[model samples]
Target: MLLHIDSSADTTADSVTRQLTEAFARTWHTAHGNSADHRHRDLSAAPVPPITPAYTTLGRRVEREGFVPPAKVPALTESAAEQREWGLTLPYITELLAADTLLLGVPMYNFAVPATLKAWIDRVTFPGALTDPDTGESLLRHTRVIAVMARGGGYGPGTPREHFDFQTPYLKAYFGSLGVPPENLHLVAAELTRVDVLPQLAGLEELAADSLARARATLTALAAA
Candidate 1:
């Protein structure tokens, strides 16, 4: 099964990242048809709850004491609030563990991922959740990840703002920590998406169009792969 995660704050019509991801999902569904299952989680429309202090404490205690089934978390904690918080966040982890592919529709917000996406990351990233506690194995080692991102400015290699591209590196590191090797992760970016609307970027429209076209083509091929 594949999990499609959309974190774009803009409507689908306005969000380049969303367009790419949706195209990917359509292509995947067409290629895999009845053979694969697909699920979508929109972080923008229905945001994941922020990790509270109680949730953090519970997660730490669970890690120290060893992993337990989500249903068994109540046995590890007496505080109802902690249990409730665990209940809220455990589903996200569960979905990740069950997915064979993780499709992330992310857009650069202030040179980084959207805050809602970060909250989702924080909620599901507790130790023993993405990693096996007994064998120290990475649950995501075999999972494929495709991150479709959009940026308002050019940040590719040799670009003046290349160093400002925190979105890609941060995601690469985040997935790497979960045991997804470099080969299993695919990144497609549409840069300078604001060129058409901003007078200062008027001459960069062709670059933006080329970037978007390439991103679309890449997503099409990757979805089939």
Candidate 2:
């Protein structure tokens, strides 16, 4: 199954990043049909809680000893003790483990990712959950991630603003820590601000075509493999 997480908060009908993500999903589905099952989470529309003190405490226990704290145990009263007695971040971790591919649509916010996306990262980045405690083995195995991001400014390689592109580097690091190799990380960025002066239909079409082509090629390769 594929998991799609869209973090763009823009609700405008013409949101470039969101539109591109939706288009990617639609194209992939059309190409693959029932061969793939998709599970989607819209972080901007329905935000999950940030990592809380309670969650942190529970996470620490799980990381250190692979167990949940006793105090937090009673809070999970609705389910069987064995099933509901873990840290709050366990569900998110499980979700990551359940997916074969992860498609993330994130917008650059002040040169970084939005807080909602950061929170999602925090939830899934638990030590001993995605990584090993001793040898630091990645528990996530051979999963892949495709990140589609949009920025107001052009920050491609060698650009002055490239140093400010923390979103891709951070994501690469986080996913790498969980055992996803560099080759499996596919990134596509749209520089919308560069189109402000041009404002021409041809320019927009060119950008969209390039991005869509890259996305389609990557998805097809992944599906075939």
Candidate 3:
């Protein structure tokens, strides 16, 4: 199963990451045909609310007491608010757990991931939910993540602004902690995405176009693979 997620605030033609992800999805679907199941989640559309105190409390309980089955949530939940939060969060966890391939369209927002996506991350990353508590093994070890990232400025190695790119590294670290090996995580990033609209970046339009083309090609190839 493939879980395609888009976090770009702009769900329009202007979003380079969205274009890349769309290309990826199309290629993937064409390659897999009816044999594959594809599920899409637009984080910006049906936004995942940020973690609440009640949610954290429930998460803490899970951490302290270990995993609990959904059928027993009523017995485990201490309050209505926690129950509601669990109701909201459980689907995200289940969706992720069922996915063999996670396709993420992530646009760099102020050099980091959008708060909407982070909220989803926070909700689903229960202590024992995505991992094996007793053995410290990650349940997502076999899953593959293809992150198509877009940045407004250049952040490649040796670039002056490279140090400012906090998006990809954070994703790598977060997924790594969740038990996804480096090889299972594929990153296809397009930089200088603002060149077409930003006056100062107009001179780098060629570079931006090249980057975007490369990113699109990579996404298609990865999807086909």
lDDT of each: 0.88, 0.70, 0.88
Ranking of models by TM-score? 1, 3, 2
Error of 3 at 18 (Å): 0.9
lDDT of 1: 0.88
What tens-digit string does per-residue lDDT give for candidate 2 at 98-213? 88788888898988889999988876775466654456566566777888888766676786777989888888887776678888787777765345555543356566556556
TM-score of each: 0.95, 0.77, 0.94
The alpha-carbon RMSD values of the candidates against the true structure, listed in the order shown, are 1.4, 5.0, 1.6
Q: Which candidate model has the greater TM-score, 2 or 3?
A: 3
Worst 10 residues of 2 by lDDT: 76-85
Give model 3's clash tally: 0
- Candidate 3, superposed: residue stretches over 4 Å from native: 67-74, 133-135
lDDT of model number 2: 0.70
lDDT of candidate 3 at residue 126, scale 0 to 100: 64
Per-residue CA lDDT of model 3 for 50-154, tens digit only, reads 889998888778777765545455577899999999888889989999999999989999889998889889988865788755676788999999999999899
